[model samples]
Target: MEEQSVVLVVDDVKTNVLIMRQCLKEMFQVWTADSGEECLRVAKQKPDIILLDVLMPGMDGYQVCRQLKADPETAEIPIIFVTAKDSDDDEQKGLEIGAVDYITKPIRPAIVRARVSTHIQLKQHSDKLKFMALHDQLTGLYNRHFLAERAAQSLSAMVRHQQELSIVMLDLDHFKKINDFNGHHIGDLVLQAVAKLLQDCFRKEDVVARMGGEEFVILMECGLDIAREKTEDVRQQLARLNPMGLEVTGSFGVVTANPQNAELSHLLVLADEAVYKAKADGRNCVVCYQDGAYLTVEHD
Candidate 1:
C-alpha cells in the first residue's frame, strides 16, 4: 500500500497544535513541534507538508522557515504559515520567505482542511505533469530528450565513480507495418503494453525511454554480460507479446562506454549499428557493440 501523506504542525501553544492535529489527523499522518528548534528537528524526517505558526515564543515561523529553506534536504517541502498576524506585512513576509500559503488564526477547521487538500492535490498534479513532460505519453517511458539528459548525467557519474556504463538501443521490428494494418490506436496500445513490460523487466533506477517511433533506449551501470542478459529479457518479453495480435518483437544494439568513446552520440551510433546488424541477421535478437563493432547472438 502507498504511504499516507505526512504533515508537520509547529506551534508553541499546545492547544493550537492539538487543534491543527485534530483538523488534519483524518487525512494525514501528523507530527507536532512546540518550538522552532523542535520543528527543525522534526523536519529532518521530511514531512510532505508543514503547518507553521508564526507567533511562537522563540524562533518564530519566519526564522524556522528561513532555516528550513536554507537546508538543501528540506528545501522542497511546502510550508504554510498559520498565524493570528493577518496584516499585509505579515503576508508579504511569509511569501517573501518562501511559504507557499498563509492562513490567519483563529483558524476555521473547514478552511484549513480545504486549503491543505487543495495544496496536496496541486502538488500531486504538478508531479504528474513533470513525469509527462519527461516521458513518452503513449508508452509512459522516458522520451528522447530525457534519455539524452539522463545518459549524459549517468556518463558523468560513471566517470566520477570509475564504473562501467552500457547503452542499449532497441527498435521494434516492423512497427510501421503494425500501424499500417491495425490502425494507429492499436499501435499506441501495443506501445503502452510494451512499455509496461520493459518497466517490469528493468530496475527502477535504470534509465528507460522511448526514443521516438518504435525505438527505445536503456542505460545501465553494468558489465557486458549483465547488459546481454537484460537485453535478452526485454527481447523475449516483446516476442511473448506477439500473441496479443500486434506481432511485436525488438532488435537491440548495445555499446559500452570507454575512454575512447566518451561522446554519448558516438555510443548511440554504435548501438544503432548493432541494432541494424540484429535486423540484418534476422530481426528479434540482441547484438553487442565490441571493439568498435557489432556481434550478433547466434541461437541453436
Candidate 2:
C-alpha cells in the first residue's frame, strides 16, 4: 500500500493550524509548527509539502523559504504561502523567494487541499522518474551508472575516516546455459530472485548493483573479514537455488581497500581477477584479493 504524503502546517495561530489540519488530514499525514524555527526543526523529518503562513513574530514565511531554498537538504520541499496579505507585490515576493504556490487568507479549504494535492502528485512523479533513471528495469537493482557514482562517494568518506572498504564482483555460473536450457523467461526469474537475495543478504548501508548481464557488484564499508563472511553467506544462498530443475551458483571476486589507497577502477579490476580465480577454482566459491594477492577458501 502506498503511504500518505506528509503536509506540514507552519502558522503562529493555533486556530489556523487546526483548520488546515482538519482540511488536509484526510489526504495527508499532517504535522504542525507554530513558528519558522519549529518549521525548520520539523523539516528534518521531510514533509512532502509545506503550507507556511507569511506573517509571524520571528522569521516570516519569506525568510523561512529563503533559508530552506538555500540549504540543499531542504531545498526541494515545495512551499505555499498562506497569508492575509493578498497584495500583488506580496505574492510576487513569495514566488520569487521559492514558494511554489500562494494562498490568501480567509482560506478556502477546497482550494488549499487541491493545491497541496497537486504539489504532492508532482513530487511523487518526479521522485519516480529519478528512481527509474538510477535503477535497472529487470532486476530492480541500481544500474552501473548509479553504482559507480555512489561507490565513489562511499570510498571518499571511508578514506577520510581511515576505514576499510570492500568491493565484490559476482557472476552467475553458466548463466547463458540457464537461459538457453530453461528458456529466457525462467532465466529472468532467476535474475530477479538473485537480486532480491542480494538485497536481503547485505546491510542497508551497503551499495549493491547489477553491472549488466549476469554480473553484479556490492560495495561494503567493512574490512576483508566481514566482507568474506557476508560473501560466503551469499554464495551458500545462491547454491541453494534450484530454478526450474537446474542448479544455480555464483562465483564471487572480492577486493579490500585501505583509506588512502582505494580507487574504484583498480578495485574493480582486482575483483574481476579474484572472481575469475573463483571460477577457475571450480565455481560456487569466493576468492578475495588482500595483502597483495588473491586468496581462496581451501577445501579439505
Candidate 3:
C-alpha cells in the first residue's frame, strides 16, 4: 500500500468528538484531539484527512489549518473545517486557508461518512492515475518515461542516503520468432506471463517496468551480490516458463551503483550493454556490468 489514509478529528467538546468517532471508525482509522494544540501534535503522525473544529479554546480551526498548511509534512493532508459557524465568510475563509471541504455541525453521520469516503477514494484514484500515467499499460510495469524519472530519483536518494542501487535490463529471447510462429495473441500471453513471473520474483518495493518491445527494466535497492542473485533468479524462473508449449527464456543485464560516479544514465547504459552482450553470447544467460565492462555467466 502506498499510504494509509487516517481521519483526524479535532474538537474540544467530548460528545461531538464521540459522535464523529462513532461515525468514521468503521471506514477509517480515526484519531482524536481535544484542542488546536493537540491537533498539531497529532498532525505530526500524518493523518490523511483532518476534521477540525472551527471554534477552539485558543487557536481556532483557521489558525490550525494555517499551521498545517505551513508544515511540509502535513501540507498534503486534506483538512475539512467542521463547525457550527455556517456563513459564506466562514466557508470562504476555510477554503482560503486550504481546507479541501467544509461541513457544518449538528453533524450528519451519513454525510460525514460519504464525504470522507469520497475524498479518500478520490485521493487514492488520483495517485493511481499518476502512477499509471508513468507506467506501461500492457505489462503493468513502469514505462520508459517513468524509468528515467524513477532512475533519477533513485540515484539522488542513493547519493543522499549513501545506499547501493542496482539496475537490471531484460529482453525476451527470440521474441520476434514467438510472434511470428505463435501469433501475436500468444506472444501477448507470453509477455503477460513473464511480467507476472518478474513481479513474483522481485520484492514489492522493487520498481519493475516494461521498456517497450519485449524489454523490461528493474530498479532494486541492493548491493552487487543481491542484484546478481535476484537477476539470476528471474532468468532461471523465466527460462522455466514454457507458455502454451511455446519456449520462453530471457536475458538479464545487471549494473550496480559504484562509489565513484553512479549516474542514472551510466547505470542504464551499462545494463543495456550487458543485456545486448547476453544476447550476443547466446541467450538465456545473465551479464553483470562492472567498472565499464560486462561479465557473462555461462549456463551448465
Candidate 1 on 166-226: residue-level lDDT in tens?
9989899998988898888888888888888888999998898998888888888887888
Q: Give the TM-score of each candidate.
A: 0.83, 0.90, 0.77
lDDT of each: 0.88, 0.91, 0.88
Write down the TM-score for model 3.
0.77
Which predicted model would earn the best TM-score?
2
- Tell me how far the alpha carbon of residue 284 in candidate 3 is from the true structure, in angstroms, after superposition: 0.5
- Pairs of residues clashing in candidate 2: none
* Per-residue lDDT of candidate 2, residues 1-300 (tens digit): 889899999999999999999998888899999999999999988999999999998999999999999988899999999999999999999999999999998989999999999998998899899999999999999998898898888888887888778999999999999888778999999999899989999988898999999999999988899999889988988888775667889999988887546788888999999999999999999999988888996532
Off by over 4 Å in 2: 1-3, 66-73, 243-246, 259-261
lDDT of 3 by residue, 8-40 (tens): 999999999999999988778899999999999
TM-score for candidate 1, residues paired by index: 0.83
| Model number with the top lDDT | 2
* Total colliding residue pairs, candidate 3: 1
Position 71, candidate 1: lDDT: 98
Query: Candidate 3, which segments miss by more than 4 Å at Cα?
Result: 1-12, 17-50, 56-77, 87-93, 108-121, 259-261
Question: What ranges in model 1 sit over 4 Å off?
Answer: 1-7, 24-48, 54-74, 84-93
Question: Cα RMSDs of all predictions?
Answer: 3.4, 2.4, 4.3
